[model samples]
Target chain A: MSDLNNGRYGIHGGQYVPETLMNEIHHLEECYEFYKNDKEFNDELESLLKEYAGRPSLLYYAEKMTKDLGGAKIYIKREDLNHTGSHKINNVLGQVLMAKKMGKTRVIAETGAGQHGVATATAAALLGLECEIFMGREDTERQKLNVYRMELLGAKVHAVTSGTQTLKDAVNETMREWVSRVHDTHYVLGSVMGPHPFPMIVRDFQSVISKEAREQILEKEGRLPLAVVACVGGGSNAMGMFYNFINDKEVKLIGCEAGGKGVDTFETAATMATGKLGIFHGMKSYFCQDDDGQIAPVYSISAGLDYPGVGPEHAYLRDSGRAEYVPITDDEAVEAFEYIAKTEGIICAIESAHAVAHVMKTAKNYSKDDIIIICLSGRGDKDVSAIAKYRGVDINE
Target chain B: MSRIKNAFENKKAFIGFLTAGDPSIEKTEEFIYKLIEGGADLIEIGIPFSDPIAEGPVIQSANIRSLSGGTRISHLFELVENVRKNTEIPLVFLTYINTVFKYGTEEFFKKCNESGIDGIIIPDLPFEEKAEIKESAEKYDVDIISLIAPTSEDRIKLIAKESQGFVYVVSSMGVTGMRSEIKTDLESIVESVRKYTDNPIAIGFGINSPEQAEKYSKLADGVIVGSAIVKIIEEHKEDSGKYLKEYAEKMKSAMKN
Candidate 1:
């Protein structure tokens, strides 16, 4: 028997799932192992990304924000410009395509901000497969427009009312659904979390972010950026933004977790700040849990960052000091959201605003010669109503 | 001999499961006694977790109610001790791995020994990941019961050979709930398991009615029912003791040779 350390990143990841799902997980691992290197698989996926989904997103320089911050030059890696208006499309297309190849007729996924659900719905529609999405009832209410968008894409959406009616509950519902229909359906886990292969698979798919950003920045500035920043919910976008730059010891990889109201209070989703080591959601990682080891009900204004735990790789990165994670409170993220919208004439997703908030705070400390890249992981269109509500301005949907 | 092993001496065993502190801890104690009175050979006490991914809605709701009632691991150990004071019936814990891991693995096993717990079934702790807690469980003489799902195919024999107490054969592919009929080919799985080990096999998950219990017991050493009983508790609350006892008697008589 293999030890608990199998498929782990420094005692963080493992196959902590029920017996019924073990064989299915093993089969997925085998398929991923085979297809990750298959030339035909790569060719087909690349074409879908380039020709269909519109790859090679722009790395636009934020000249106005750079001048206003009066420090480091800023560039926004525009993953927000993807087909589904988010970085979620990168992994959704890959997994849905793999599902098609595996002879699976249906795909299921859990979403928080509905970005992932929309992306999965889009991919399943394109691939001629049935799609279903599980979203927390709270998220469905907050991101109602995206819910409609998914419905329009011909995907069934289930509002998971269990627990806190948020992202965590949606995951629980999705996992339960997959356990029942593992043979004919595939679970397109949205983030770089869950068990071993999921974290590895999603990270690899999203790594295209840093792969293109690296070449783009190097081509434009003739050097790697001083820092790479992205928001961390389950840390998919952050892992994507940080993966290629991990080898460059000089490039600072910073991940921003949602602080909700504040980290000191119970109402926060800052896993790196308030979480401890415990297993939940099929991975041993940092989880915000109560004394009895019950998973906590985490809160965040940005529904995308409202999860209780960060990915195992993020836990490893924090422990090894290879990367740094900071908490961005709702107030700061909102300020950054409005700041960027007014200054740069671009409204980034509230999830991406967490990273932008971090940059806004620390960019003034960097030298003018320094360059930093912030991954605008999604567009702000889905978050406008929620942000307006947060600002005490009601805009009826 | 281990209490769990002795539970299946000559006759087919009837195992009962319920979440501790559902409605209230006192009611759970009452429910267990009622099961014993109804001729349950062995009992499985669930330590309610915050997130039970493997469970269906019935057991999941029980977990939430148990947690909301302020049921803690310490309370469960005390409950086990209380149950032990009354009967010598074999008792085990059914819970997720995180509960034990968070309570400290070695310390948790030690408490199990002190509280007279015979075995533990962690659904998430598969055969491959058993090394972490196997030592602690062995040190405390607590059997780490192995579960074989319909999907466990080739791994059934591998797990069966190393099994200590009764092997829990899941009756269906999904999470635990009452089913009208089970369609999985469990006879072949049991035959494969019998080739490797002489341990008792108890099929669980969706075995609710007495007819279903009798039907499944014919193919295995025992039949375990959970959600059906939990549904009774959900319906009757604190007054579920007599209903549970009557139901258990019917299921036990149905399974008896």
Candidate 2:
């Protein structure tokens, strides 16, 4: 059984949702346990990951970046090469397949930057199940191209106008929907957050990133990297990138957070850096909240990382001192986003740029013999317009 | 027996819910006494949080209005203390877990005891996660009420078995909103809960009119009207107390019959 089933990472995770949704979560936990070790389930999931979503994504050496930083030899785990463009496809594929195995006819998900929603829609289309996605109204405007992509994939996109109309509100809207349709529908939660089974399930599916990267890095560099890094939002990619290297005590695991303008300003989503322990979205974790404990409205240029809360497991890791989290400003992320495109000819998602920004600043601290593998979580085609807007250019023109 | 248990002994109880400090604080204080005087057997006060995920647009808007009107947790507690001076009826807090956790769970419940509150209903804290808070609630003598919705199939028995104060049975499958019709086979649900424990059940969510209360009360020991009462506070503003008195009286009479 998964260690997370009891939903505690030393007092960080638990099912803190409404009683109306309790039975569904319990049933989900039971299903996850039964199928996790089941041979048939694993076999089918493995086949899908390999044939459909393109597993074993490359770990490419960033020679130009290494030279630019003038210190360590850097490597980028190209999760962007996955079929749906982001590491989110890894978890979506696993969840949609699980929904099929559980006899669910429909699947629902919430998205911020539209990456998770698109991945879910793609998986649902392949599995021949009905798909519905909830995106914040603000997100639909910011990431309009992704809205079109989801609709083209045959998923209905609901523009959630509630609350701040961002990822947090989208999560709230999806949870409400799931409660109403729990009988025949499954909520394909995008991140390693929310209630129990989800954090465990997403982490397990995404852990394959570090699993493959560890092997690839060993083959190429003859040893584990000095450090591994990824961006943290609801923290799927970071959790995935850090999971395998956790026990390798010498290997540092760092998570970069979107520090919109600055942590000193209210316009930030750096949960671990500036948040307090509070219960929201079914988990007791670090949440950006006001004095009264009400969830504070968070912000980031990268919509995907603009959530008020981090995954429960991330909270556990941070508290245990197993992993370190740092803030990456929007200016730093945008600079990295442009630099990688210019040097490596790769347009990376603004979300992934947060990690790249972290690497760009700290890579020079290590010697040339050191290896630093960063999780490049997604392609940036969906973010082209947003990037253009940030640069004061009209990409449409 | 607790006041909540005693409430169900005489006849079918009428439970009214309101988001404290909605419209204005003074009017909310007036509505509290009017709610009890209008025959509210038990009261559920809502501490408005920025994100109330379980609520529909009606209560959601009400929450927004209350929060924007500067309804702080401290203000709500003060109002609760004021209300305690007037009525000894069972009062429960219907709030999200974040608010209580923010206030410090043990501290929140301790204040509940000091201020004469009987129970609390956290819509986001399910049965499996209750142990942590339940310990604090027990130490403070505050009943952590259990809620069983229509979606709770086999788990109804489990929830009812461990429920304190009374069971809150959701009338429909959706969030808190008034519905013209409630099609769930609630009698069977009540029967399932009964197989576990003899806890008195109060049906809520989607109940608004006297007719709906009359219908649902037949299946349970009490009827909880939330969105309807909040809708009154939403529409009437400062004058909600007069309308709520008439509405609460009418609904309570229907539950009794």
Model 2 residue A178 CA deviation (Å) reads 0.4
lDDT of each: 0.93, 0.91
Using all chains and alpha carbons, the TM-scores for the candidates as numbered come to 0.98, 0.98
RMSD of 2: 1.5
Candidate 1's TM-score reads 0.98
Q: Kindly list the per-residue Cα lDDT of model 1 for residues B51-128, writing each as its tens digit.
A: 898899999999999999999889999999999999999999998888888889999999999999999999888888
For B1-257, candidate 2 gives per-residue lDDT tens digits of 88888779878989999988899777788998898889999989988989998999999998999999999988887888888898778888888888888889899898888888899998888877787688899999988889998888878777888989998888788689999988999999888888898889899999898998898888889999889999999889998888999998899888777
Q: What is the lDDT of candidate 2?
A: 0.91
lDDT of 2 by residue, A1-397 (tens): 1235377876788888877788788889899989889999999999999999899899999999999899999999999999989999999988998899999999999999999999999999999999999999999999998999999999999999988999999999999998888889999999999988789999999999999999999899789999999999999999999998988989999999999999999999999989999999989899999989989999999999999999999998888888999999999999999999999999999999999999999999999999999999999998888888889998785
* RMSD after CA superposition, every candidate: 1.8, 1.5
Clashing pairs in 1: none
Top candidate by lDDT: 1
The two-chain DockQ for each candidate, comma-separated, is 0.80, 0.83
